[model samples]
Target: MADIAGRAGVSLATVDRVINRRKGVKERTRQQVLEAALALGFLGADEMARFRDRREANIVFLLPAGTNPYLRDLGDHLRQRVALREEGSPKVRCFFIEGFNAPALAEAIRRNADWADGIAFFAIDHPAVREAVAEVAANGVRLVTVVSDLGHSGCDAYVGHENRSVGRTAGLLIGRFIAERQGAVALVAGSRHYRAHSEREAGFLSIQEEMFPHLRLVGMREGHDDSGQNYRHTIALLDQNPDLRGIYNVGGSSGGVARALAERGRSDVAFIGHGLTKDTRNALVEGVMDAVFHTDPETLIDRAIGAICQPERQVLPMKLEIVFRENLP
Candidate 1:
């Protein structure tokens, strides 16, 4: 204890509290002491035995199911990371919810509350979802919102990028890329139910109104994060507004939008979308898509695990990355 305290620049009492999992110690202090103890080999055989004897934590991840490459890749990456964990680590299980509607997501949370020590999900900001999150939290399960957030829903923390900033960046890029600033620009989203999507749309519109006054937002549509739906919507938007100068896709189905633009021989139109998956990468390479905004899924999962296991710890905002054809890795 003395060695740990000295190494961490804290008192012996603080080290004692952290090792015993006692409350009142600030999370940063606790982490410092824990790291010091591990580095100095202060946790002896007895301490290791005590830790091993404690009840195993069960963390459940509720992810969306579909052909959306980003979500699919996130789920796959998390599963692989959890599977590769060494023995004695917490058990991590992932469940995919179909359609990603509020009711289905709510029910999944309710059902998992009985078994999950921690719950993480891509949230829809709806009353039913909030109620479900509150109920799970009341049952003593730690909640972490990932990718999308449910505001004030008793969640312990959020682990994702600043979505509104991502939207504003997209809007600014599209505005600068468009040749004719006076023409109409279209916006496509997955669903208004997702706070991330709505926030992105709001940011995009705000920047367009403030900086690009001549660019008119002619149409907005929900693609449900489905490629087929996005393709259809893009086709309709082009048909209705033949003079459209740009398209901003604030959702997962950028491939569909790229396909639609290609079919209509409208590759000249400024196209901006989210995610850097194979589909979007190919589109960017083929000059069918302009820019893509993305973040590392592996980093997201790491922060989510920290948020779940150490409920008192704070999760820092994820960095948003923009990928272009010239910077393909």
Candidate 2:
């Protein structure tokens, strides 16, 4: 047992757990122990091979299917990373359902509960989704909410920023960039159902009312995180409010906002939004977008995986990064 432990780079207790088929040992460590035992002639080759067939843990991601560049990139990055791993590690599967479909999202959560040991996804704050999250967490499944958080829904961790903070930052930047010019500022959101967007909208509104009393806040519009809808909204907002001085998008519709600004020849208007995507990056470089914010996809995924592995560990909110034309990394 000690020889196997030394060979496997594990403690004697772990070797004992693997040898006795105990529940606590991780799959990779268990496999290593079995390999060492086989090398030492303590177990038959066939036996070790048979035991190796068992998988460690199953993790599933239920991401929203959307045209939002940031979310699409995040999902793609996650899929690519998970595909390159060895056989014994946790197997991650990603499924895309329609964005903001409460029933479909709830159903997906419940459907995967029996099989997935850990589940990560974009969260909606609807009651049905909350109930489903509660059920899964109660069953000991680790749950992490990615970009849009629903931590109050009993999710184990949230893998995104404190959205209200992001909003306040946006508000501050937009307000200062326009620099005491008195005109209407408009807000565009991805969806009303997403709590993150709502929180961001609230934060921006609060700061705008508190500090920028000189500016009038036009009513907000929901863009559904779709570029086309966002473009239309921005065009109308600009046409109606010829005095519009700035725009704050509480969602990922930076592309639409930029396009609208260009079409209306309002590039001089201060625009602030989320995601440091190609469109937004170019906008920043060209001075079309005043500022944009983002979080690293790899960091978010790593934080979520840690929470999933430990189950009870506390996962901190992922950091938010603000980008400007001068600091375009």
Most lDDT-accurate candidate:
1
Worst ten-residue run, lDDT, model 1?
21-30
- List clashing residue pairs in candidate 2: none
Highest TM-score scorer: 1
- Looking at model 1, residue 227 earns an lDDT score of 94
Please provide, for model 2 over 1-329, each residue's C-alpha lDDT reduced to its tens digit, 9 standing for 90 to 100.
Answer: 99999999988988887777554454556678898999999999788777766547778888888888988888888789787978677778888889889989999999997778788888888999999988877655778888788756778788788888888888888899889688999999988799899999998989988988898999889998888999999999988999999999888868988988987778879998888888889888877888888888788777777777765567777777888899888
Q: Give all candidate RMSDs, comma-separated.
A: 7.1, 7.2
Runs of candidate 1 exceeding 4 Å displacement: 1-56
Off by over 4 Å in 2: 1-55
TM-scores of all models? 0.83, 0.82
C-alpha lDDT of candidate 2 relative to the true structure: 0.84
Candidate 2 lDDT trough over 10 residues, lowest sum: 21-30
